[model samples]
Target: MPTFTALTTLVGKDSAEKLGEAMERLTPEPTGVGVFEIEDGSGLWEVGGYFTESPDAAGLAVLAAAFDAKPFVVSELPETDWVAKVKRELAPVKAGRFFVYGSHDADKVPVGSEPLLIEAAMAFGTGHHGTTLGCLKALDRIAGEGFHGRSVADIGCGTAVLAMGAARIWPETVLASDIDEVAVEVAEANVSANGLTGQVRCVEAAGFGHPDLAAKAPFDLVFANILKAPLVDLAPEMGANIQAGGFAILSGILNEQADEVVAAYDAAGFDVHTREEIGEWTTLTLCHR
Candidate 1:
């Protein structure tokens, strides 16, 4: 196994709390990767993590080379090869009947069930983050009740996990969209990998700005797992897109932020049904009024 080094800087103890909060929000896993923090004499601090893999060397080199051009006194940690390390932890993850795999060349989706292989990027909703898991649980809850063959939309469809989940749960078709083209690409790939390419379609859209966004009108089911601020900003449009008595799932909220998120939708005329929590994250289910 090859071992590569990583470096992280900190801006003093004063920034520790904020940095810690950011880390928690980011939730960078430290297995195939490990993170450590460093403090400079001037109170500035740097935190870094390393990947341990031989195959990942090329990718890591590209990342390291890019950092070399900058003169922020970037510290270089001991070299570690991480290809094998990441691969070991990147094993296929099975959740219920759905299968989630990494993006490496060795990343292969299971033949049975639904296979969703996503590039292991820094983006959330690779079906590994807590928010993603909460959304998945919320999805499972909605799936138990069934889709009633109604249309659905997965807003902020990072990797289109929930959308794919909906497609797998019911034969009903779903439209998934994301603001990031990269995420959309990953989502499209995942949809095809899962054999639900025909059922769940991915598109690029900034919020509800997609040209085809309005065409899916008054969807019977809507799932939006985004941050609190955007969730509040989208309240009006969310109300407009969901049909009366239809269901909507909202996630990407912290425990303390749940009520605020629920209030946003409540004011928009959604009646709260249930709020699901996993770890520090929360997912709320509501019915359009």
Candidate 2:
């Protein structure tokens, strides 16, 4: 398959964050599709955000039409290809079990003993994004403390990386949900691929407090790696769903946005547990009051 490049920028720093937040809504849905063709163990490939699947010739046009992006398809010299390009691009990220590449790296988790391999595609959760890594670290902290019989609710679970991490390290019961069906599908695939279907179940939910979630009230741990505004809006609901003394992990906030987000949690009855930062993003862990 031919490779493509989408080099678009948000209007400014603030706009960048807003754009990133908006793009998140498109994830876990078929908003984009990518195909990687490997030849001679390497080929030209691209990791672009797409809103729909169409003929290769039409992919760029579709992207241009659906979103404000500069989408252009590109190929390499006859011998050199996209896979090699991605490999080179991803090489620097090989520090841990997870390596995140590209601009959308905030949506995945790349931790734990077993390797979490996710191609940089239109899907979320490639272990490189700040939101994903921050949540991973928070999950690791919880797991390290030993989650014996705790119950976890992964809100806005995207690719279910947090759910899988909880299952891998803590053996806790996990319920992972995403607003996007495509995200749920990808999460299911990853969970199954990692042999975690029994511990983690992926489902679709518009947001917290959905009837189904209410049915599973009082989670020992609640994790949501969504943006700042939504986190604020869901604070009350999150506080209600978490059991007293349970842990709550919140992400998807830029470092500068951390305090405001944390205050929302505090006002909703969650006590500050710990806060960590990765690059421009921050992760806050709290205890439900």
Candidate 3:
């Protein structure tokens, strides 16, 4: 059996979402359809569909034309054990004192390293992508600068890698939240797996809305590894939640989009502390003024 993906990028969120909904109605219906904003400051949204069978090209063409999007680039995916493949391809990533790896590489954890276990699973933030790894590195850098977190939060904490990282290094209760309930569940699972059940509390919330997050406001550090639009949207709320002189580690931004995110935070009373680029992604460390 082969999997197929049909992907395209369009100008607006509404149209891209409409195209994603339309993709679900194809004759050989897609198993899943997703709409995501491109984080390159391009103001474009990408709509994609995954199919167990080959998609209807003409049907895709109709949807693209209706949405005024570029034609879908459909590709057949080969059958393979993706988990095993990921385990083979993704070696352990080390950021300062933190070592992130899966259980498959349990034996490889180096001596004297603060280990954070993030298995290759359905959720994001596995520490393999530049975004997650960069966040870990930023956190490591801040810690190296003699910063000790009294309070911390990880917004959009997929797999709670950042939360667990903070928990491992600092003596603080880290609140980890995600808009998706499933991601929160995965985060909790990861927390428990890493023996951080009491240190890292997982919740489902959009940004800083939930009571658990709000109650723990004026945090010393915050980690948000989501996309550019959300990062920009989160600035004011993030400023409200972080204490004066607090730190923020942000990623999931393309190299070209770093300036846009930085400007948004600057307007919200934060100043750039550090910037790191890993591959096409950029991670920013900012201090609340």
Tell me, by TM-score, which candidate is best.
3
TM-score of each candidate structure, all chains considered together: 0.67, 0.65, 0.94
- Tens digit per residue, CA lDDT, model 1, 39-134: 112544453443343223343344434433111222334544455555556556566566666667334665665555555553366666777777
- Clash counts for all predictions: 26, 21, 0
Pick by TM-score: 1 or 2, better one: 1
Q: After superposition, how far is residue 98 of candidate 3 from its true place, in Å?
A: 0.6
Model 2 weakest lDDT span, ten residues long: 37-46
Q: Across residues 1-289, which tens digit of lDDT does each residue of candidate 3 receive?
A: 8999999999988888888888888989899999997756578999999999889999999888988999999999889998888888888888889998899989999999999888876325777789988999999899998999989999999889999999998878999999998888889999999999889999899999899988888898999999888999999998898999999999989998899999999999999999999999999999999
Query: In candidate 3, what residue range of length 10 has the lowest lDDT sum?
Result: 119-128
Evaluated with lDDT, which candidate comes out highest? 3
lDDT of 2 at 281: 85
Q: For all the candidates, what are their Cα RMSDs to the real structure? A: 9.6, 10.5, 1.7
Model 2: per-residue lDDT, tens digit, 51-147? 3322244544454445453454433324356555564465324323334344334344454443454554523465567778777777666656765
So what's the TM-score on candidate 2?
0.65
Ten contiguous residues minimizing lDDT sum, candidate 1: 67-76
Model 1 lDDT vs. the true structure?
Answer: 0.68
- Model 3 Cα displacement at 66 (Å)? 2.6
